[model samples]
Target: MMKLDFKNRIALYYLMATSVISILAFVFIYFMVKDTMYDSLDHSLSYEARKHLSEIAVVADTIYFTHKKEWEETEHREVQINPVFLQLMDTEGQIMDKSPNLKEDHLVMNHAFSGDTHYNTQLKDRPIRQTQIDIKQEGTVKGYIVAAIPIESSLMVLSNLSRTLLGLFPLTMVMLFLISRYLAGKSIRPISAIIHTTGRITKNNLGERVPLPTQKDELYDLSTSINGLLNRIEEALEREKQFTSDASHELRTPLSTLRGTLEILVRKERNISEYEENIRKSLVEVDRMSEIVEQLLFLARNGQASDPSLQQTVALAVLVDEVLSRQHKAIKAKQLRISMESNSWGNFEVPYYYGSVILENILGNAIKYSHMDGRVVIELNGDPAGCYCLVTDQGVGIKAEDLDHIYYPFFRSDYLKHKQIKGLGLGLSIARKAALAIGAKITIDSELGNWTAVRVSFDQKVS
Candidate 1:
């Protein structure tokens, strides 16, 4: 029910695995030693039984050791400290003879077992390893010689071994857990650094990045990805700040102009002609503000929603013609000659609203910037690969250095030098955003004071 952190969990898992292995190893060692002790005792018992059997004489159901020196051994005489006991039993289970060490306690013969066999039994409440051997005369059954050795020393050795293993188990587990926890903490140190660094980052310090680890492991990759995301966020924030500043300036210019005009008209009495003229000027400023607001809204809307369902099939040539028509007044004002060139192409599947916005802005720019009586050419070309609409104009072309920033909202090329050109500098920005929304590519190429050309390419979709 309780939760552990990554480090503790790793340590716990390692300890659990080690504990199982250590317990098994301890058990194996204890049993191996116990078996070795028992085997040595059984071997000794067999040798003692064989020695006694050679000295014993069996004469027609009567069995007795011929050598009295066999019972004179120190082991057969003593009851404690590695003592050996010897007992003889007949077919009727009556004891024929026994060593002095087993004076009151007799080794019980097991009838269920015959011949030579080793087993564990008690003598005077003390543990011992024992064996039974038959004494035969002329290949005829006579009696059994039971030999035993006290096993208290071997049992004490095993008991001490067991206690030692049991005591070390928990200590070993604790040591393993501590070592594992330390190593696990070291392994995830990079993650800790990342958390601390990222926590300190805020909007005011957007440029700061997380430090990357030297090793190219998973943690290093994670840090790299986090830095990349921070880069994007910083860039976005910068663009947002620039956009807000520009929008405020562009909107304020028209508002100030309208306010100045209205203030002048109300200050003095004027005839219908003067009044109507001032009202017209104010209305023009109002229209300019409204256009800027509408363009801003269009950009915001297109950016927020790009639903595929808004796309429909539209004829590229027809769309170009419609945009050209909308810019008819500007073209007339500039006295620019318009030309249209079309290759074999079918209708394109694109978001019609955005497509129209892209074309309108591109065409408007061409018309607005072109020199008087200059040529403006519209070319629509397509094949199986894709479709492209190219609009070129003999305009006061953009500078080479300024080309990169043309897509930025309210960014104009040489605005101070070409102050007479009337625009809020959002045409290209809107056009690019709209083009992107409709899955189109727009490219611009121009030479200063010579010509400017804009091209919009669409993916292959013909109907």
Candidate 2:
């Protein structure tokens, strides 16, 4: 067996349904016509039998026609063109009299039949519609009157009707199938166009979008959804390209510094103090490159699927204190002032690794970006609804326009102006991703060169 495509399938289904209805309709029409012809013949035969019986009389114990001229009628005498035959028979089944048209042949009388009834029988080897009536005197059935008419013309009409219906059925179905197939093709033309358009789209042509249909139906919705998906893919690809370019530039700077320092050191011999300073400088570049690689790896790993078992109840205040302690050296170097306020909120259920990463990066950014002797506030506030941790720093804050792009990996606002701040821009990006993994949200509000506040809100809690 072969499989049919959508258009052919649609046509076949339509044809199947129509075929059932057409078959029933044709059968009904043929039967209705056949019944009509039989009914007309029966009525004519009954009338003829009644007329002949009216002219007959029963004398004592015998039956005979009172009017002899009834047998001389043209219809009774002729055997051609709508000929009707009449016969009379005794109770014992002997023929008493018959029409001249019947010649030597006689109509059959069925003894098994009771009352006046119409049926089909043959006379002289020709088909006929017949009816039988009993002649009686004082409730005694002395004889029976049988009347018949030829039915060959009516049979021929019915046969021709059946043939016409049978022949036209197949032809009509063929035409219906063709029309249905054509309509189905036109209906799905939009889908074909969508497939063609999407097939041409590649990474290089991600901006291409599918054309929408004129009607705002299901196909239009499908086209709109595909275009929306393409938009997202194009955006993600662009961000990926930018991230790669930034990562390469950042890593290359440290490598060049290391290479240049080593080349200078190997060029000529240096005294102990000069050698020590150069070695320390080279170590600083090596450490910077190592930090960049480590953060890149952290971002990549955080973006993957996390294990559910790693989730546990974590005290927000404790996590905040630990992050601050880890960044003590940076705070001390900048002489920054740290103040923490907590409302004694209980531990919340979260992925521990992701929670720690979120806190570590948020606090680290506060300490790194704050000016010397500037104040930094850490607030932990919670209710039965949710928990919020806010870290605000009074430092050279980010510009209002660049706030939206801050979450992009390796995105830095005013890098040349903040060159003294030695760090990769992946802190906030990493923190945001970690927060998302634990079903948390991060919001930042900042003014250029004034102050910045970062807030992490957790919607999940330990019951």
Among these predictions, the greatest TM-score belongs to: 2
Q: How well is each residue in 1-463 modelled by candidate 1, as lDDT tens digits?
A: 5799988988888888989999999999999998898888888889999988888888777787788886788887877667889998897889988888888889988777777789888887888888899887778778889888888888899999999999989999889999999998999889899999999999999888999999999999999999999987886776667557667988888888888988998898989998899899989988898898788766655252347566555788888887788888888888889999886662555456778888888888888899999999988887667888889999899999999999888889999988988888899989887776656889999999989999889876422
Candidate 1 to truth, TM: 0.76
Would you list the C-alpha lDDT of every candidate in the order shown?
Answer: 0.84, 0.84
Model 2, runs deviating above 4 Å: 2-5, 43-61, 65-84, 99-105, 110-118, 133-141, 214-236, 261-287, 290-322, 325-337, 344-358, 382-387, 399-418, 432-442, 447-450, 457-463
Q: Deviation in angstroms for 86 in model 2?
A: 2.7
As for candidate 1, its clashing pairs are: none
- Candidate 2 lDDT over residue span 39-158, tens digit each: 888888888999888877776556666777876888878888788898888888877777788898889987777667888888778888888898977787888888899998888999
lDDT measured at residue 201 in model 2 versus the true structure, 0 to 100: 94
